[model samples]
Target chain A: MATEIVLISLLKILVVVLTILTCVVFLVYIERRVSAFVQNRVGPNRTGPYGLLQTVADVVKLLMKEDIVPRNAYKAIHDLAPIISIGVALSTFAVIPIGDTIELFGRQIKLIIADVNVGILYILAITSLGVYGITLAGWSSNNKYSLLGGLRSSAQLISYELSMGLSIVGVLMVSGTLQLDKIVQHQTTYLFGWLPAWNMFLQPIGFITFVTAAFAETNRLPFDLPEAEPELVGGYHTEYTGLKFGLFFLAEYANMITASAVITTLFLGGWHLPYVEYVGLSSFILSLVYVGTFCVKVAAVMMFFIIIRWTLPRFRYDQLMNLGWKLMLPITIINVLLTGIVLLILH
Target chain B: MGSNGKIIRKKDLNFWQRMYIPEIAKGLRLTITQMFKPKVTYQYPDEKFVPPPSFRGRPVLVEEQGVERCVACGLCSRVCPALAIEVQASETELEKERYPIKFEINMVRCIFCGFCEEVCPEEAIVMSNEYELVFTSQEEAIFGKEKLLTPIEKLRPRLEWLKNNR
Candidate 1:
């Protein structure tokens, strides 16, 4: 029985990692296509049939390129930086529950990789560690531009993480659980019988704060001060070459996917479709439906991320700092207080 | 905040503008609308761009029937700012009295400036609509007479364009 459990768990891990890596590659392809559409240009249509194999070609190119390590750089940490970045990015998805449990071969299998009780906190802690990869890469590169990028990334984290934490606290207060699966279960209840009780509807301010903070945390546009190409010239990963650079690139998209999944799970009701229970499907079919629903929701969120990247101009460094510290921080704190007060009055 | 010579004050912004959320929404709306708009990309090589007569692509030597119109006057070499054109004159039995023994255009140095075409006395060199030039080596980029000469029929549009526009 124990061996069977171990085998299933191992299978689950393999599936999750492969799915995330594949998604990362395709997400980059999607991002490029979306950006092209926005800019009124054709993007990457030559690789293979509407550029389906562009990411594969890109991977092959990156693999074949020369891996140059600077003579003045710290060799060990420079090599370790991308590994740390990608490791943290991929590992954060372990707690995300894609769907409810399934009964197969007369035994139940939970969909999540590791069902940690402190799922939200675990996510926060792991995401915070991602900054160290950038910081260490910058410091070890022995390049001034890289160092500046690393410093900006750390500062951005410090300013925005507080708001991000506070925003999630509102969701936690409403759901009354730290386990992510329970939070999703809490969100399954409907309001007025037609409208699903997603956390975004209840705590709109927290949703906005969390999403914006997620964008900053992912080092995406408007908050991508760390790798501001015009100013910092590829930033912390400037000195990295070949697959090392590819790893940083992969880690970024992976982080974006994780953020999208978390947002869907938290605010959008993970696998629970609106009025899905009314279908009255069997357990196995229902689980499949739930997984499909989760994927669709995550895809929608991912599209939003890509759209926003092409839409807005990068925020000035001071503006970024001000938005994080002055605006988002206070607004999220107030939102938490409001949730607390409402909860106290109700119960 | 108004220390710069521009003298823009931060206090001028109202509460909504200062909040920035509404502005961001407006930007998002603009971009999303743009995504639905028709793209202007020309898939080059698959669908070649047929440039107008006024367009100056690579300069070519005009071949009329079985002979080139070039008298090898060397004026193009003198007029070329980039010094891209080189012509060697030799005695010829043709009516022009002198024909180019060797004509080479270092395309790497050629800026597509149309000066060579403008300076040619015999109407031999004119800008053709052949813009796609690919070379794997520096030597391959240097066009000899075999590469530089194009049949007048293939270059009618550009010649007609040069006639009307110039």
Candidate 2:
């Protein structure tokens, strides 16, 4: 029985890791193609049918390039930085519930890899560790530009993280649980007999603040001051080359996928397909449908991420700081207050 | 608004614009609309660009009936701003008696300025519409008479264009 449990856990881990990695590759391809379209140009269509294998080709090229370490650099920390970045990015996916618990081999299995009761807190903590990787990479590299990039990234992430955490408090109050799966299940009920009780409807301000903070946390455009190419020249990864640089690129896309999944699980109703239970499909088929619905939601969120990247220009450094502190922080605090009052009155 | 001679800042944006999300939605709508529009990119190698007759490309000597129209005047060499052309004239039995014993154009130095073509009184030198030039070495970029002498039929469009315009 113990052996079986261990095997199931291993299988779940393998599946989730493979899915996230595959999603990262395709996300890179999708971002390139979508950005091209936004600018009225065709991007990377020649590699494989519509440039499907472009990321694979890019990986192989990165693998072949020479790795160079600067003579004045702190060698060990520089090498460890990308590993930390990718590790934190991938591990944050463990608590995100993708689908409902299913019966397999006469045993019940939850879709999440780690069913830790403190799932939301785990994600917040792990994602915070991501900044350390960038900061260390900047300090270790013997370049002024890299140091500045790392500094900006740390400040940006720290400021946004306050609002990100504060925004999630509203959802926590409404759902009444810290576990992500519970939060998702809470959203299965209806509001006024028709509307899905997604936190997005229950707490609109929280939803907006959370999404804005997520964009900043993921270091996406409008919040991508970390790697602002015009000023920082590739940012914290300025001194990185070959596979080390590829790892940082992979981590960025992987972070995007994880962020999208978190957003879906928290605010967008997770794998709970609205009104699908009434259709009465077999248990096995329903489970498959649930997984498919989860994937589609994540993909739609990722599409939004890609489209927004090309639509908005990067913010100036002072402007980014002002938006984070003076605007988002205050708005998120108000959202938390409103959610508390509403929840208290209803209960 | 500018008639008052005062600068209006982005901060002065009315309530709707200052809301930020609605303005962002507007920008997103514009970019999404652009995505479906016909792309202006030309898929090169698969689809080649054919330049007009007036386009200046590589300089070449005009050949007529298996013979060059050049009188070996050396005017093109003199007019070449890049000093890319070299001519060694010798007496010939043909109607154009002053034929070149050796004519070379160092493509490495050629700037595609078309000055050599413009200075050619015999109309023997003209820029053809063949722009795909590649050289692995400096020596390979130096074109001899064999490479520069292009058939007149292939250069007819450029010659006619020059006649009408000049």
Every prediction's TM-score for the first chain? 0.99, 0.98
Screening candidate 2 with a backbone cut-off below 3 angstroms (N, C-alpha, C), the clashing residue pairs are none
Model 2 misplaced regions, further than 4 Å: B1-11
lDDT (Cα atoms) of all candidates against the true structure: 0.93, 0.93
Give a tens-digit lDDT track for model 2, residues A1-347.
Answer: 88987898899999998988888888999999999999899998989898899999999999999999988999999999999999999999999998998888887888888889999999999999999999999999989999999999999999999999999999999988999999999999999999999998988889999999999999999789989999999999999999999999999999999999999999999998999988999888888899999999999999999999988999998999999999999999988888878778988
DockQ of 2: 0.85
Best candidate (score: TM-score):
2
TM-score of each: 0.93, 0.96
lDDT of 2 by residue, B1-166 (tens): 4779987676667898889999999999998999999999989998989999999999999999999999899999999989999999999998778998899999999999999899889999999998999999999999999999999999999999999999
